[model samples]
Target: MTQPPPPPPPNQPPPGYGYPQGGPNPYAQQPPYGSPAYGYPQQPQPAYPPPGPPQPPTPKGKLNAQAVIIVSAVAAIALIIGGGVWYSSTKDGRADAKSGDKNSTAGTTGGTGDSGGTGGGSGADKAPANTASKVLFQLPQPAIGADGNSATVDGSWLTDTVYAKSGFAEIVGYDPVKGTKLWTVPLPGPVCEASRHTTADHRTAIVYEPAMPTKDKPSHGCSQVAAIDLDAGKELWTRTVKSGDQAITLNNVTVSANTVAVGSTNGGAAFDISGKVLWAPKPTDTCYDAGYGGGEKLVAVRKCGAYGSRQLKIQTIDPVSGKVLSEYAMAKGIESASIVSTNPLVVAADVNYSAGDGSGISDFFSIDNKTGQLRTKISAPGDKYAAKCEGITKIEYCTKVVVGNDRLYLPTESHDGTGEYSKTNEIVAFDLATGKLDGQRADAGDGYTISPLTMDDGNVIAYKSPPYDKGGQVVSIDGGSFAQTKLMENPATKAVREVEFDMQPESAELIYADGRLYMSQVFADKPSTPGASDYLAIAYGTS
Candidate 1:
């Protein structure tokens, strides 16, 4: 094409500049005949529509230069805000992954595979209200076979013992908040069993008995009872009792303000803190289950008759002096009975036989602690199969009975016709004062054989051992409505074994002192390499 009038000079404005100061004309009318329009020259039509809708006329108070500056500043601020939101979302995702909670959904905290619930906080912020009452502490190791025998939580310190390869047990004190070992006390022998009992004021007493000898040798004797200083971890005093000629089986031991009671193959015994014998019951054929009541009386159960058709003799003895304050002879008709006492009341259970097919029966009872008198005998409303108990090898049929402050919690296992332990679930709470069933019966034994329940402030903390599973779960039952809460999952290991590879699991003994739930476990597993003695400690309030 003929060089279109040679393009205007590159650096200078196009020809026909009409305005001064090199500015475009403010008022210029276009000439006819296909020429540029008024005020400016005509450009080619745009290939696309205008970027946006036409702007409205500027307001009277608006400033053109300052407005441009403000608009740019507002745009910058919006971009900064948007970038921050994006960064925060990315950071939260990374944090969840780092916490080993990859499965957690956005906006949710803890779930089945997560350590915390949706409401869980990182540090000490009050946990989300929906979280299962948090596990204050979960011992990394199991309790059984471990050197750490008994554990008790007093204030912030958790005191326990672990066994050494040298056949001795080492006592350890741990801080629940920091998970640090506070102190340790070395013992002379391996601990067979250990328990932590508390007084009303929250003081802790740890009792440990040495393991029994093998079947080849006769039993050594009962475990020595010792009260250790909670702060010093030193023995306050040690007393040895000959519970029986055979190896003693310690069921449960409890301590009050001034007295400590130890249960063994023989009946239980109560002693003062100074190692003086307060009261020792004569050995009876039936195993004795004992608990202390307010440092004043010892509540115990004695056998009175044959297995399957046996009787229970409930007695309350004075702690200050070795004297039986009151005794009640429960007849043989009752199926199972236990001593559950808080203060003014002591509750017991009695199973009565009915005429129809042995399945028709009424099984329940309660007693007053002050008078050792029967309070109420209501017909336990449930089928026999659902209201039975386990852990009674000698006795054909039995039900576990547990006592709490306001109610009595019972778990019963019924066997199939073939005499094998079958799945039967039933938990009944009897009102301590009125002897009436509190709310409705809770079904805890279903698909599992529930053990004798434990309590902390009327809450039931017990194990549910099911078939095919080596271990059991720790469940918590609330007192207000008899609701159930699965507090923690039991590890996959048998609690008792000659040589366990995996750490054994144990249930928590709920202790509410300063608004925290304290739990302890004994871990007993063979050392992976030689030369390591098994160890155990009490872990409470997991972070």
Candidate 2:
């Protein structure tokens, strides 16, 4: 059964009921084809049946009243039916338009215009292909001696040249862009570690710690903190650091423009460039974790108490005064924490809580450096990546998470499916401000694992290696979309087998600055005698 249209709203006409006393309908004139008028392509007009001959005139005499009334009723019903069809079609068109808008916002698959494939198309997720330049230069092997550690070198990128800890007694500099030796400076002892930092004037300085002596070589016992001016190619200052009566063996060195932080086993100290002691380790803190300094502030972690029930504290200090400006204690169950970044500080650690699936989880926290307040906390996925990696040598795999430039990247391990325990490292990025996970995860293909080395210019450089494979390749992951791309390959490293030793591959000591990657290939295979592998700093272009 058909029903008449409903009445309109108060003071409004019914749908399609209003009409003007006009000569023609507004919609009657559509553009013609290929012409501005009628708006349709112009074609030869089609022939229609010729108009019928003029109808005979009706009789002018008085007509029957019943016939007139029936004709008028039929006309009104026809107008109402026509108007109903037009109104329904218009409403449907509007609904379709709204649906399209929502899909665009939610992210559509197979969308047009170069959108990334894995997650929703984001402009930032575009892969950085063809950004690496040709291999600039290959570093020569370091000179060797009777001691095995004498030939090992660790390299870091400075402003223009590559600074390296060469043979225990000297720092070597190389011209990466020009493929030439820059300068070399003699040290008091073998340099076991080196870190390059910038001063207030942007001059480069290499802060280093000498190697500890073995029982066989008592003469090499060294506990000195020294600095070398990379630009001037000379030693700036050197001083013996002592804790009580024993020499302090530094674990790492963190540097800023005006201050240098020397991290040790139980405590650490901060000093100025001119060998002035600015601060020393406090007695309350026990073991000190890694520290990082930048943008006029330094942040670090300190832990105390027993291993089972320990407390981890975060401290931010004024780089110039060495005063602890702010300190905050992490929530309970935070097993351990690493300072992933200093500027707009972020930390990554495991929260010892069981999930709904009965697995485990990890989280990254963004902290306010000034107020010691936690800003945001983002939870990680349960892909067996948050498992405790005790004794893992690769810092990127175990500790060196990164947060910067609007993204927080963590190296996570995933099952390879070939064996019950076989896994490899992959990078997962999150929103730094909100701690939301991006849908995509960056990988370095099968049989190869990726370890993050540095992040710059919306890209992250990772060292990619295969188990029991020699050498490694440098790859880049787009921070925005998590797309992976290969940048460079090095064929110098030797295959390190885990079957025999049951140890993770030793990390390739490396650092990046000014669009270049500097690596000290200590385990690389040498062409000559057995167990006499050559080592040197190799520089590669990243952007």
Candidate 3:
């Protein structure tokens, strides 16, 4: 009765329906009322209307568009992760390969390998231990005459004056190796007195003074220069020059490849190799020392004024052309002088005197040969410790300053006067370029002194005075570090009346020829048989 059941729920179909009921029945037209529709199977109506809009009747056996998109996104994410892992692994592998290659190369090249190679062997490794071999030449005696004058050891030849039966003098040479006589050359005359025998470039130069004549005859009063052959013991040539009424002495006679230069009491002169006078006798106030510098230059010291006067002159002349290259007027009161031969420069020292006491004051000057200008002047210590060229009486006074291999070596003697001969030797080395001391000064000893100090290939070889002996000790010193070692020792004699006795060594020289150290000694001896001056040869080992 309620209005006919609300019009049958507004004309609603049953639980499930497809299109309009009167619309010719959409499935009826398609499958004859669902009797075996499409594949021949009868189907019941769905309990509820098939989802909304029937889902557009999906095609049979085909994937949906949404499902295809979801599967594709998942596959892309997996591929990205896999690619990242593979790239990281490949890069690490390449780095390892490069490291292995570097290690192999370093091992083959001998590098101090801290990475990628074995670190065992290198040039920094220490060397094996082995004893270094050395040779030593010893001479028992090496001086001549009671006064020890005119004694020298040049190389393998020892030259000195020996007393003859007729009260004459003779110059002799002895083989140092065998202790046998090499040769004997008689003096020019019975009265002729020998002074010094020096060698340069394997040749010997003999210097002497003629004997003075008595009331029976007038004295010649001349000095002679003779170049002698060392091997043959014969005089090559002789030249006699007048020496005023007084005795004229020679100093530093040097023979080089093309010239012979000698310093005399009055002046200096240069001669050719064949004895032709290059520069004739030139008058100088006081030409006491001279030497040949490198090239064609001659360095000489001249006393400009009278004795006790202050002014002295240092002259550098051209040996080949006799031209004055440079002249330097040293301090006013110069008493002594010394010249050192170094490249591009020349060093000279002047010993000055005080006003009242005449005490010694040394002034050192460095001159540049290229510019002819004074480079620097250094004032030495006071008189008590100053270095002076107190004549050639002591070789230390003459050869105290030595120049070699671009370095300058200066030896100073102690002034306390407490040791043997009242001398203590000390050596100092300086760099020539910078004019600075290279290392700490070396103290040779208190009593032992060195004379004729020289450098050979950066090694300093000097004749040292031993304690309680007048003989000499050969010492080798390192130039770089001032380290010293005594190479050999020569002892002096005790007997005072012996005629032919071994004397102390006054001078020494170190000659490195054919890998041997050849040393010659000139000893003052009075032989029991009364012959000429006794000379000896001493040869030792060198490396």
Candidate 4:
């Protein structure tokens, strides 16, 4: 299987996808209401106990004293009744979950039970062309308890529903459009790092201990992989995997077709959808990491030759029989390869620095799904790489650079090395048949600073946020005409005040699925009430 990019150096931590460099402190307490941090805007605080009914004015004249007395009595009675009704309402709306509890009070029922919808509003089927956005709902950071151990919550979009892990070791399903709490299922442990996949049939999740292991305390714990029936909120099956004798924790898990594959530092494992083990952990020479090639083939990479002279090898395997169908050796100077797209079977190759300074060179290849042959050598845009995978790569890039029926949608930048965007950017559609670039260059979001989110119905959903500002917007790029249309803008009322010069492009996500775009951001609105948790704002894309 194709591998993810190499991890960060020992001194630095791996950056979070769709999150800030170090990520938000899960154990950190909520900030005070109405208080702006670093000059960002504050969410309007909620009023408690509401204001009391207004008192009627007193009568000034004696002749109207009797009338005043009758009026005052009636007014007092009415106030009492109103107050009673208000109190009842508050009582009915009282949150069942405690201050430090991460469980949803409304959707606490276990196993596929519906929390029902709390209707807010629906995103319009057709929205104006302007980049106007509104918050559909706010999801609070789940309370992981006071153990100081917190799960790194990651969200996956399936159609209009979002499946996110709560800090409390539970996966909560939410409806982004209706602001509804759909369902919650407690997991046996916290999520394994970058171990989630959303497919048409089901959602795959890997839960394990301590999001990140340190030098002293490596992950000796067990990592469990489970297939979740999205609609039923039930686990199809779960298998626990150890880090092997070396304490090498599991790294990536992917589900494609009927197979679910898990990769680790030591080796990897693959299983059928029914939890049937198709292959066991083996040496890198035999199995290693694998991902879905365009069709039913599983692509895996192995190192050939001695430690120093080893070359990268790509193997195409029959996923069901676990048999290698064919193999291809990458170029002699290519050091490593990462899967860029599963549908198009695209892989991005890194340069072998030991050979020589391979600057101004970027290599991409598309494999023929059936023959496992090198189908086409996709030309990198000028001197720029289609993907910037030098450091810890983002998930956005992992699924971007799409390869379609006959065209290739690639994101490229004219300038590099700024750690932000190039001076010029374009989504170039390449004619797959000729390996030549398409003439029509589409204008992407925010110039060269935008990131590709997803491709739907032949259109690319792109995301853009101004450097150091909260004014981000999601736009759709027409696959053919290359025309761009802004779908939605930032939902946050306030943004970070300090200048974020080199903010990570994956710090936010704009997912377009089920005919709607769901936006999820780190910093968002605060819920009303003293003990209420601050929520991640969810914005919707109208038709």
lDDT winner: 2
Ranking by TM-score: 4, 2, 3, 1
Give the alpha carbon lDDT tens digit for every residue of 1-543 in model 2: 999767443322113323222233211221111221110011111111112111222356321110000000000000000000011112101100011111111111111111010011122322334544334565655543443422223334344333433433566656657656778777544443344334533232332335423446523332455555555565655544444445554444545655656554435565565555555544333344333433335766655443334466777876655556777788643444645556667665656533222122366678888888887887764453432221100111122345556677765654453432333556777777677767667765544566665555667766664433433455667767667676554443332221111112232345444444454442222335666433344455544
Error of 3 at 24 (Å): 99
TM-score each candidate: 0.49, 0.59, 0.53, 0.62
lDDT per residue for candidate 3 within 288-357, as digits (tens), equals: 3333332224455554443334255566655444465677777664434555442435454434333121
- Candidate 1's residue-wise lDDT over 4-36, tens digit each? 445333322223222233223211211111121
Ten-residue segment with the worst summed lDDT in candidate 4? 70-79
lDDT of each: 0.36, 0.43, 0.36, 0.41
- Model 1: how far residue 365 lies from native, Å: 3.0
**lDDT score, candidate 3:** 0.36
Q: In model 1, state the lDDT of residue 6.
A: 50
How large is the C-alpha RMSD of every model relative to the true structure?
37.3, 34.8, 52.7, 19.9
Off by over 4 Å in 1: 1-168, 193-196, 200-219, 242-252, 263-268, 280-297, 303-311, 332-337, 342-364, 378-405, 409-428, 433-435, 438-523, 527-543
